[model samples]
Every structure is written in structure tokens, then in C-alpha cells.
Target: MTTEIATLGGGCFWCLEAVYQELQGVQQVESGYAGGHVANPSYEEVCSGGTGHAEVVRVTFDPAIVSYREILEIFFTIHDPTTLNRQGNDCGTQYRSVIFYHSPEQEETARQVIAEMANVWDAPIVTELAPLPAYYKAEDYHQNYFRQNPLQGYCAFVVAPKVAKFRKIFADKAKSA
Candidate 1:
């Protein structure tokens, strides 16, 4: 099966990583930093907003089962794309809503999804659609953060809600446990 990667940042990478991990077509999800100025940004540096990076997840999925547009649909549903550089109480450039498209087709698809999803929110969608400049895998501790620390405070309050929302909104697309 052919697989394509979608890199997205919608608030904390932990939230995005957790939700995407449950999607049916998804093969893997890696939490990382993207669209940043740093060569190898640490979680602390990115959190400080000096790297200009968004906490992102590089999702590997089989397009035969789930289309890229569908992935973006899940993305929009789980996070507030209308709010720039923030999701929920998390506020920082690192927490911005962004799609770092891997190709021209992916770029176009992202724009189309944003346009279609705009009507759902009172404010215009501010999700940045940009060609992926560079992606630096975050520290191993950040990967599968929710699953590894499900009872952690942030995971319980912030990440778990997003996963629940994804499961409810895209039940058909969710992976069978």
C-alpha cells in the first residue's frame, strides 16, 4: 500500500499526535517541530517561541483507506483553526494551527479544506498553509505523549478531550482497537 505523510500543527503536538494515532488509515504519527528557524529545536526553545516553530505531528497514512482531505477534515474538527497561533488555553507560535504541505497538491488541498471549513466558525480560518521547510523530530519523550502519559494533567484535560472529539466526529475513520 502506498502511504503519504501529512504534517500538521494544531495546538500541542501531543493533542494532534494522539488524535491522528487513532485514525484508521494512519500508520504512524511522530511529534516534532516544523516550519522553524532552529536546526534542532528543543521543546523548551520552541515553547519559548524563539524558534518560530509549531509543535507538529508527521502522520503517515495509507491514502487507499483515507484521503488527505479527510485527514485535514479531522484536523479542523479537533482544533480551532480560526484562532491564530493558539488552541484552547495554549497560546504561542508553537501552538499555532498550521499545515506544512509536503507537495503542491497537498498545498492546494489544504487551502480548499480551510475555505470549506471557514463557514463553520464565526471567525475566518487562520490556519497557515505553507510548504514544509524543515521538520525536526522532537525528543523521544514527546512522542506518543498522550498514550505514554494518559493520566498526566495536560493529557487528561487537554489531549484526551481532542481525542474524544475526533472519535465522535469521525467514527468511521477511527481505527478499531
Candidate 2:
């Protein structure tokens, strides 16, 4: 199977990781850091907002099963792109909405998707679009955080809702349990 990668940061990486993990064509979803100046930043360093890194997820998917545009559509639905440097109570530059495109085609698709989504939101879309940069995988404990810590406070209260929203809104695209 052909695999394409999409790196995205929309609030907490846990939330985006949880939702993308359930999408049908997504082969792998890795919580990570990107769009930053630092090298191999730790989660705490990123959270401090000094490393310039945003909490991001590197998603590997099969384009034949799910197009890049469809992946972007789900992304827009699951997160508030209008809120700059934050999603809900999560704050800091690390929580900003961003899309790190891997190719020219992916960049074009992101631009088009953002433009279309702008009409849907009353506020302007603030999601950043940039070419993919150096990505550092988050700590081992962070991978599949929601699946591993479903009852954890943040996972339960925050990540779960995003996962549920994706399931409810895009049932057709969700992987079978």
C-alpha cells in the first residue's frame, strides 16, 4: 500500500492523535513536535513555549483509501482553527493550529481546504500552513495516549470528545472497531 504523511498540530497532540487513529485509511499516527527551531524538543520544553515547537501528530495514511482532502476535512471539523495559539483551555504556541504539508500537492490541498472552511466559520481561519520541517517523535509514553489512558482526566474530558465528534460526524470514514 502507498503511504503519504501529513503533519498537523491542532491543540493538544493527544486530541488529534486520538481522532486520526480512528480514521480508516490512517496507517499510523505519531504524536510529535514540529514547526519549531529546537532540535529534539521534550514535551515540557515545547509546553514552555520557548522551543517554538507546536505539539503535532505525524499521520501516515493510504491515499488510495482516503484522499488528502478528506483527511483535511476531518481535521477542520475536529478542531477550532480560528482560535490562535490555543484550543479550548490549552494555551501556548505549542497548541496552535497548523498544517505542515509534505509536498506541493498537499500544500495546495491545504490552502483550498482552509479557504473552504473559512466560509463555514464566523471567525477567520487562523490555521498555519507551512512546508513540513524537522519532526521529533514525542516520548514513548505519549504514543496512543488516549487508547492507553481512556480514563485519564485530560483524555476523558478533552481527547474523548474530539474522538467522539469524529465518529459522529464522519462515521463513514471511521475504522471498524
Candidate 3:
């Protein structure tokens, strides 16, 4: 399998991690921080909005199974691309919508996808599509957050609904395991 990487930040990393983990082509999803000025910023620093980091997830997937466009499609569906620096009640710069493209092809696909999705929402898509600068894996506690803390209030209320939507809307693309 030819593995490709896609780094995305749309709301919390936990929500993105939960949704991508169930995708058929997805091999691994690492919750992290990206599209920021700081290097190796901690979650608290990101949350403070001083670090300028967005909570991101670096997904490893097989393009043969799911194209980069498909990944962007899922991303657009799962989060509010129209909202700037926030998702639902979670308000912060770290919760902003962004796509850190790994290649020229990915960059082109992301732009095309955003243009196509323009009619989907009344507001213009605010998702930042940029070349990936760097990715720092979040602290160990942040990895697999939803799976590890399923009973947590935020995971149950926010992340779970997103995951459910992913499974229901992309049923054909959902992983068997």
C-alpha cells in the first residue's frame, strides 16, 4: 500500500482523530499541533492562543483506497469550514479550520474541493489551505483521546456526534474493524 499523509486542523484534534480513525483507507491518525509559529508547543500554550498553533491531526492513509480529494471531502463534512477559529462552543485559535497539504497535488485538490463546496454553506469556506510547515505529535495523553476517554464529557458530547455522523454519512467508506 502506498501511504500518504494529510495534516488537518478543524476544531479539536480529538474530534478529527475520532472521525479519521474509522475511515477505510486510514492507517494511523496522530493528534498534534500545526500551522503555527511556535515549535513543539504544548496543548496549554496552544489553548492560550499565544503559541498560534492549531490543534491538528496527521493522518496516514493509503491513497489507493481513498484519494486525497476524498479525505478533504470528509474533512469538509465533519467540521464547520465557515467558522473562523472555533467549532461549536469551543472557541479559540487552536480550533480553527485548516488543511496543511503534503504535496502539490494535495494542495490543488484542496482548493478545488473548497470551490466546489462554496454552495454548501452561505458563508465562504474559511479553511486555510497551505503547504504543511511542520507537525509535532501531541503529548501521549492526547493520542487516541476519544478511545481512551470515551466517557469523558467532551468526548461524549462533541467528538462522539462527529464520529457518528462520519459513520452514517460515509458508511461505505467506514472501516470494518
Candidate 4:
């Protein structure tokens, strides 16, 4: 199976990281900051929105098991891409909807998915489709956060709901632990 990378910023990386980690073809999901100006910006720097980075998850997946289109399908369904730079109570540039395409094919695929979602949803799709940027890895605690802190406040309240939705919508994609 060929390997490909898909960088997506839909909201908090922890939420996205948790869901993707459970997917069948997804090998790794690293929480990081992308579409930013500064290099290697700290998590705090990104939170302040001064670095212009969005909290993104870098997903390494096997194309044979899961198509890039399917990944994008999950991405659009789990988060509201219509809102600009915001998700739920989290409002900032860091929480914006963005697709950081690693290659031209990825770029086109991302755009096509957005178009598909737009046709299905009543509201226009506002998800940003951009070229891959220098992705600065997030802080240590942010990685695999939902698994490590499942009962933690944010994980239980926010992360869990997204995970449930993903599971319900894509039960076939779930990878046995």
C-alpha cells in the first residue's frame, strides 16, 4: 500500500487527533500547527493567534485501506467547515477549517471533497484549501491526548462527542485496538 499524508485543520488538534487515531487506515495522527507564519511556534503562540497557525493534525494513512476522499469525508462531517476560524466554543484562527495539501493530487482531492459537501449541505462550504505549509509539531501533552486523558474535562465533554459521531458515521473505518 502506498503512503500519503493529509494535513487538516478543522478545530482543536486533540479532538481531530483522537478520532483519526482510531481509523483503520490511519497509521499516525500528530497534533501540530500549520498555515502559520512563524516557524516552530509554541502551542501558546498559536493560541494567541499571533503566529497565524491553525491547530492541524498530520495524518499518515495507507491509501489502499482508506482513500484520501474518505478521510476528507470524515473531516467535513465531524466539524463545521462553514464557520471561519472557529469551532464550537473555540473561536480563533487556531481553530479554523483548513486543508494543507501535501501534493497537487491531495490539493485537488481536498477541493473535490469540499465541493461535494457544499452540494449536500444547505450552507456554503467555507473550508480553506491551501498548499502544505511548515507544520510545527504541537506540545507533548497534546499528542494522543484523548487516549491518555479520556476522563479529563475537555476529553469527556468535547472529544468524546466527536469520537462518537465519527464512529457512528464511519463504523466500517474503525480499527480494532
Candidate 5:
């Protein structure tokens, strides 16, 4: 019956945005920047690392339909948590794996998820489980990037494949949305 927001950064916002948007119980997904010191950073500023922002997706979801744990599971599966400050070809602190929790319970669940992943996976999870911060929404063009620009080069080459894989794996979750 309750709604919750989970802000995460694991890689390109386009990729994360595409994956989470199709999820069941997810009300909305906004691509943004967080865990940064600079205020109201522009996309260019964050890319330069001067803003210290990580590319993130702020997701609003119904907890009754999808638990926070399930969201975290999807997050961990969508990207490589072991690659510190990078995801695939994109390399930067801006692409770092992070979970910005709004409450103590979210923090605990994030930590537990990381721990469980570390045991099963060879590499230690480098994902940062941190307190939520002020998130600066990305530019308008960046919103719904994959859906709006499905045929665009980046969406086609970078985001679409990840999204396809996610949808294939999490088909049931998305179908119910």
C-alpha cells in the first residue's frame, strides 16, 4: 500500500532507465545525478567529474507490488557491481554502482544484498550503499531516452540490448505492469 523511491547508479542512465521503466509496481523512473557535492550540476559538468555526481535513476514504486529487495535484486543483475566507478565501456566515477537509501531499512537491505552477492560472486561488490542525497534531474532530452529514441545510435547500440535482456529475464514482472 506504500510507495517508495529507490535511487541507484550503476552505469549509463539510459541503460538503467530502459531496464527499470518496464518493471511492475514501478510508477515512474527519472534519470538523474546523485551522490555528488556540486549543486544543480549540468549533464556536462557531471560527465567531467567536477560535480562528483553519479548517473542515477530515481524510481518510484509500490512496495506492496514489488518489494525493495526485489528492486535491489534487479539493480544488481542489470549491471556489474564489481566494476568500481565504471560499467562496461563507460569509465568514470559517474558510472559507479550506488544505492541511495531513503531510510534505515533500505540501507540495511542494500547492505544485505551486497553481502549476499559478494558471497556468490567472485568479486567483492563495490556498490556503495549510502544515504539519499539531493538529486539533480538530468536534462529533458535524457528522459525516456531508450523509449523515445529507440533507433538512435546510443539507444540501439548501448541501451537496447541491456533492456532486451532485462525484459527477457524479467518478463513476468514487466508483463504485469
Candidate 6:
């Protein structure tokens, strides 16, 4: 199967990772750091806001099953793109809304999607669009965090709601459990 990569940072990587993991076409969702100059930054370092990295998820998906636009549509729905450098209580540059496109086509699609979403939201869309940069996979514990820690406080209150919303709003797109 043909697979494409989409790197996105909407808030906590756990939230994005959890939602994307449930999407039908997704083959793998890796929590990671991107849009930074540092080499192989640790989660703690990125969280400090000193590494310039955003908490991002590298999603590998089959375009034949789910188009890039559809993935972007879900992203816009699941996170508050208007809130700069934060999503809910999560704060810092690492928590900013961003899309790191892997190709020219992806970049163009992101621009169009963001423009359309601007009309849908009352506030302006603040999601950053940039070419994909060096990406560092997060620590092992971070991968599939929600699935592994469903009862964890942050996973329960924060990530679970986003996952439920994704399932509720895009039931047809969700993978069968």
C-alpha cells in the first residue's frame, strides 16, 4: 500500500497521536518533535521551550483510503487552531498548532484547508504551515500513550475527549475496533 506522511502539532503530541491512531487509513502514528534546530531533542528539552521544537506526530497513512484533505479536516475539528502557542491549558511554543507538509502538493493542500477553515471558525486560523523539517521520535513511553494510559489523568480528561470527538464526528472514517 502507498503511504504518505503528515507531520502535525496541534497541542500535546499525545492528543494528536491518539486521534490519528484511530483513523482508518493511518498505518502508524509516531509522537515526535519537529520545526526545530536542535538535533534529536528530548521531550523534556522540547517542553522547556528552549529547543524551538513543537510537539508533533508523524502520521503514516494510505492516501488511497484517506486523502490528505480529509486528514486536515479532522485536524481542524479536533483542535483549536486559533489559539496560538497553546491548546487548552497546555502552553509553550511546543504546543502551537502547526502542519509540516512533506511535499509541494501537501503544502498547497494545507493552505487551501486552512483558508476554508478560516471561514468555519469565528476567530482567524493561526495554524502554522511549513515544509517538513528534521523530526525526532519521542521517547518510547510516549508512543500510543492514550491507548496505554487510558486511565491516566491527562489521557482521561484531555486525550480521551478528543478521541471520542473524532469517533463521534467522523464515525465512518474511524477504524473498526
RMSD of candidate 2 to the truth, in angstroms, is 0.5
My TM-score estimates for the predictions, one after another, are 0.98, 0.99, 0.98, 0.97, 0.96, 0.99
- What are the lDDT scores of the predictions, listed in order? 0.92, 0.95, 0.93, 0.91, 0.90, 0.96
Worst 10 residues of 6 by lDDT: 40-49
Query: Candidate 2 residues 1-177, lDDT tens each?
Result: 799999999999999999999999999999999999999999889999999999999999999999999999999999999999999999999999999999999999999999999999999999999998899999999999999999999999998889999999999999999
Per model, state how many residue pairs clash: 0, 0, 0, 0, 0, 0
**Deviation from native of the Cα of residue 86 in model 4, angstroms:** 0.6
Model 6 lDDT at residue 84: 95
The per-residue C-alpha lDDT of model 5 at residue 168 equals 81
Better of 2 and 5 by lDDT: 2
Which ten residues in a row are the worst by lDDT in model 5?
Answer: 168-177
Candidate 5 residues lying further than 4 Å off, grouped into runs, are none
What local lDDT does model 5 show for residue 149? Answer: 91
lDDT of candidate 5 over 22-74, digit per residue (tens):
99898999999999999999999999987789999999999999889999988
lDDT of 4 at 30: 96
Score residue 87 of candidate 6 by CA lDDT.
Answer: 99
Error of 4 at 125 (Å): 1.3
Could you tell me how far off, in angstroms, the CA of residue 148 lies in candidate 6 after the best superposition? 0.5
Deviation from truth (RMSD, Å), model 6: 0.5
Off by over 4 Å in 4: none
Q: Which model, 3 or 4, shows the larger TM-score?
A: 3
Error of 3 at 114 (Å): 0.3
